[model samples]
Target: MSDTAAAEAPSPSVRSLLIMAVPAILVGVGSALVLWLLDLMSEGLQHILWTTLPQSFGATEATPWWIFTVLTVTGAAVGLVIWSVPGHAGPDSATTELVEAPLRPGVLPGLLLATVIGLAGGVSLGPENPIIAVNSALAVALLARFVKAIPLPLAMMLASSATIGALFGTPIAAALLFTGAVAAAKGGGALWDKLFLPVAAAGAGAVTMHLLGGKALSFQVTPIDQTDGWMLLWGLLVAAASALIGILLAWALPYVHRGFHALRNPLLISLAGGVVLGLLGMWGGPMTLFKGLDETTELLRHPGDYSAGQLALFAGVKVLALLVAAAAGFRGGRIFPAVFIGVALGVLAHVLFPGIPLSLAIACGCLGIVLAATRDGWIAIFLGAALVGDPVVLPMLCIIVLPVWLMVTKAPELVVHAQPESAAAKA
Candidate 1:
């Protein structure tokens, strides 16, 4: 087409965008509701397991023995659900990403069951992966049934975006995450044109979650009001070290998974994993339990209460818990647990070196670990900034992420790829 003809061609109309927004908004709101419901259910179950039952036993709270028992039983229950329930809890979570093709509607119930059990049972995994899968499957089915105008891919994207927004309590996180994927797609529209619907969906989801009393992902930290050359150096060192730890965990994940799967029976593998996780929980205490959101807040609430050695121990135990939980076939996401690890490591850094600013250390530590774990620069940086709720750390994070990214760019990711059918069948 001639330049003049191309210039005169009409772009996607605002009316069309508005029309699509209706379903996008619905998807967003629905996604938030699903997440909220899951949280409610999980919290109730958690209270029962950790509080009611403990009180009934004449303890004010869970003892080490109690943590071990509950987690072990949780593992057995999840294993039974996966082994006997339909859809086997929707594929081994270690084999999936944050987003994928929609699962069959039949698979969602079992997946949700396993996820809730793990979440409430104090497994270290987060609700992101299973919740996203659940939302995507439902969204796709509903859209295909009632709104045929939207394509399956678009529906899936909308659902994933919405869930991510709800997960992080902000649409910006979703937009930052999807920008590269959308921009690289083989489409003909401007970038904003492509982003419009997903962003709309994300916005709706974020707003809905906020209205529903979902807490913000960010927390209070001593703000870094000033920056210096030493701060930059500290940020780089902390981030790089944190990234290395995350990368090391990723490297070990497959082997850990292989060892667990060697048990062949899902029940045995999960049961064994639960035993290990329970032991680790005993060591890490309740601070290292759950998905780490509320725990992270608690950790930051009184950093002075923990010695440097205690911080180190918490970070170490949490890492082990995350590894065991993911490898043992528990259904959940790794990001939130990873964030907790990063925060702990950052706190350790501050404790060890009082000269380093706490907020900067925490931000850099989170940035490096998240970048290594997710292999997504935007998300890594976003979480780092969000954790501190400060913009002053952004420029530092952007710079520090470069070297950490290079360190982890060629490392194995914290996911298990599916084996070939022949190998799988033999195994």
Candidate 2:
């Protein structure tokens, strides 16, 4: 055996690692497929749903009261399942856990069901990680049934790699996300993992999306470069606002996480939660109602067409939607929504402070949320600038991300909630 292989395999030898990696490859590919398919179905489902929402009865300026009722009822059905099911609902997930969870092949059904309920039932959650849970459960169940000899770690690694590749919308991002998550989990020998599997999976996912002609998460716009010297000040202002918003959002997470924990009647609890969110949705526009990443893309794509009321309405609504989504029984990602919120906030800044370039405001706004979500200045910088697609905004994204990141870190107590362990150990 080669010295490198001998030293680095998850197992004792290069041969064993190679043997294990085959299943990992299957996992990566399959996970990509499932992730895309589930999201496609869920998004379609959500679309059909919005049309049916009971807004016609009491047509008001924003979301009506019936929107709350429908949301509550939908949440109640989902809550019933969560209340009955064990090992699902209301906890940090596999990615967030930083570790591979205990493998129970039987758990896939519960996880997927809960996730469907989460997305379809009006919760503002993302599908990527939940798909990981469902996929992990499915893999475990299938392996135990058909391939009893497969090592647990191999199964999990494959599943995770696939999930990462497909969900992040790129293989590279998937590799980084999974690697970071694994490191946070503290799994030794995880560094030995190759990027090949995840990359292949990302290709598979992209292929699937293209095949379906599905609307992609990203809408890379033609960047507008009209940068001015005034952006330095603009970055600072956006950073400060982001910090304030971040701190408040962080402060609310515990209460939000805890509220779900304390509810007695799970269905009614979700209903009540739904009502609160419904009310909040009244403030944030319909774009803020769901996860809002796609809606944000739609908004940015046609920003010139929207009137001032339209933009202001979205700004207020997104903040409330995020709060409502978290407070209720819905599950999903936050950073993307936070980015949208940041952009809308930046849009608000554009309206208020006409001197700062709109592109700079957009950059600082989006990055500020990323900084809050990850507490990573570097990632924040890249994401913020990349999102706006404007070179002029790049400098400000870098400058402002640091201050916001620093502010997020300053209040360390709230940031570290319940850290889950790495999957490699358990797997």
Q: Mark the 10 consecutive residues where model 1 has the least summed lDDT.
A: 418-427
Task: Please give the range of 10 consecutive residues that has the lowest summed lDDT in model 2.
Answer: 418-427
Residue pairs with backbone atoms closer than 3 Å in model 1 (clashes): none
Indicate the TM-score of model 2.
0.77
Q: Model 2 segments beyond 4 Å from truth?
A: 1-25, 52-63, 86-103, 139-158, 178-193, 221-230, 305-313, 377-379, 391-396, 412-427
TM-score of each: 0.96, 0.77
Clashes of each: 0, 12
Candidate 2 lDDT for residue 35: 73
**RMSD of every prediction:** 2.5, 5.9
Name the top TM-score candidate: 1
Q: Please write out the lDDT profile of model 1 over residues 1-427, one tens digit for every residue.
A: 6656644556578899999999999999999999999999999999999999988887634489898999999999998888878777887888889998899999999999999999999999999999999999999999999999999989999999999999999999999999999877664557788789999999999999999999778887889877789899999999999999999999999999999989877788889999999999889889889999998887777878899989999899999999999999899999999999999999999999998999998998898889988999999999999998878898988888888899999999999997542233223
User: Against the unseen true structure, what C-alpha lDDT does each candidate score?
Assistant: 0.90, 0.60
